[model samples]
Target: MIGALASQAPANAGSPAVERGQYLVNIAGCNDCHTPGYFLGKPDMTRYLGGSEVGFELPGLGVFHGPNLTPDKETGLGAWTDAQIVAALQTGKRPDGRELAPIMPWHAFAKLTRQDVDAIVAFLRSVPAVKNKVPGPFGPNETPTGFVMKVVPPAKPK
Candidate 1:
């Protein structure tokens, strides 16, 4: 399975690291939430890994936005070091010391081999830098409060 996953990487034209990273990101479904329009069934490859406005809302936990993974200096990972990237993936802690929401699946990502994680970083670095500033997670103050539930009775047996 790992072999198959790696094979999906792009051709190692300039850097084998970047190719492997692209492949890993694809198989791991990183674009699903990080890349806008992915869930809508059409991803804008031009803005790949540029983050998304549509975020995750986990009620009491808080609302989370997928941050840009591209190398944009102002709004992305351009300022992040390779070690920091690896740390984020393995520990779910951002460079700022804040914890990433569980919706990011950092726990599952922590299981990835070191080489794979490095590849992801390399690939992210190689992409074109997009100046898109993703909003931070909305805390309880900014998020809406309340819950709604509906119950239905069971149908009669035949």
Candidate 2:
């Protein structure tokens, strides 16, 4: 699967694969959490793919911000290596040695072939970075408060 995305990855410019990645990024629900303020509206197109902050005040959840997912030189994944990204999604660890908390659905994503994952990352790399400062790695699910985020229900294990 890695070959599929890499095969179509545009070298000098954004390729069709990257565009597809962007589409998947949205369809896969990456925007819901990675992009904060989704309740109000999408982030400015100028800051497409930029991360934001939203407090998770539910019982099992805690206050946290969705950090920048853009390719900005400063507050984004610009400095991260593809390996770092793949590892984070597959292993739940940040480049800084921090656990990404279970909020991010890297589990479901982890099933995707390496190539597809790369395409998503490729699309992320192509987007302009936003200067949003995400807050925390809010641990645990909030079962109390009015909010109850349904995590991916379990499927028969392979």
Candidate 3:
């Protein structure tokens, strides 16, 4: 199923690197969390990788939305350099010196080959920029303004 999806490249996705990246992004399930309306059974392909309207709520970490990955300067990764993107993927550290939310699986991505990582970056760079600004990385005490999928720990047996 993923293979079929990866076969259809985005309009701007050209070059070997971009294609490879698109494939990687699809197979890696980047859309599962990043694309808006995805968790709600409707993925907005028009705003692909443009960030999610829903957030994830960890017990003590508060809610975090899947941020926009498109290259829009005002609301997405446009200002981030290739190195910054790579670092965020591999190290779970944002360029602004903040650690990525725990929901982000950067540890697994850390094992990706350098070439693969570079390809992913290329693909991300080539996508059409979306102007969506996903909501917060709200603090534990703060209230989130959007829908959230909470992750609750299993209860201990008494």
Q: Which candidate is the best by lDDT?
A: 3
The residue-by-residue lDDT of candidate 1 on 25-133, one tens digit each, is 8888887777755556666666777887666666566667777888887899999999999999999999999989878889999999999999988888877677776
Enumerate clash totals for all models, in the order shown: 0, 8, 0
Candidate 2 residue lDDT tens string, 19-105: 777667767866666665553454344444466555444345554555688876678888899899888888888999987765678
Best to worst by lDDT, what's the order?
A: 3, 1, 2
Better of 2 and 3 by TM-score: 3
Cα-based lDDT for every prediction = 0.74, 0.65, 0.90
lDDT of 3 by residue, 1-158 (tens): 45535544666665888888998998899988988888998888878889999999999889999999999998999999999999999999999999999999999999999999999999988888999999998999999999999999999999
- Candidate 1, TM-score vs. the true structure? 0.80
- Output the number of the TM-score-best candidate: 3
Candidates 1 and 3 compared: the better one by TM-score is 3
lDDT at position 117, candidate 1: 94
Worst 10 residues of 3 by lDDT: 1-10
TM-score on alpha carbons, each prediction: 0.80, 0.71, 0.94
Worst 10 residues of 2 by lDDT: 1-10
After superposing candidate 2, which stretches have Cα over 4 Å from the reference? 1-14, 41-43, 58-61, 138-158
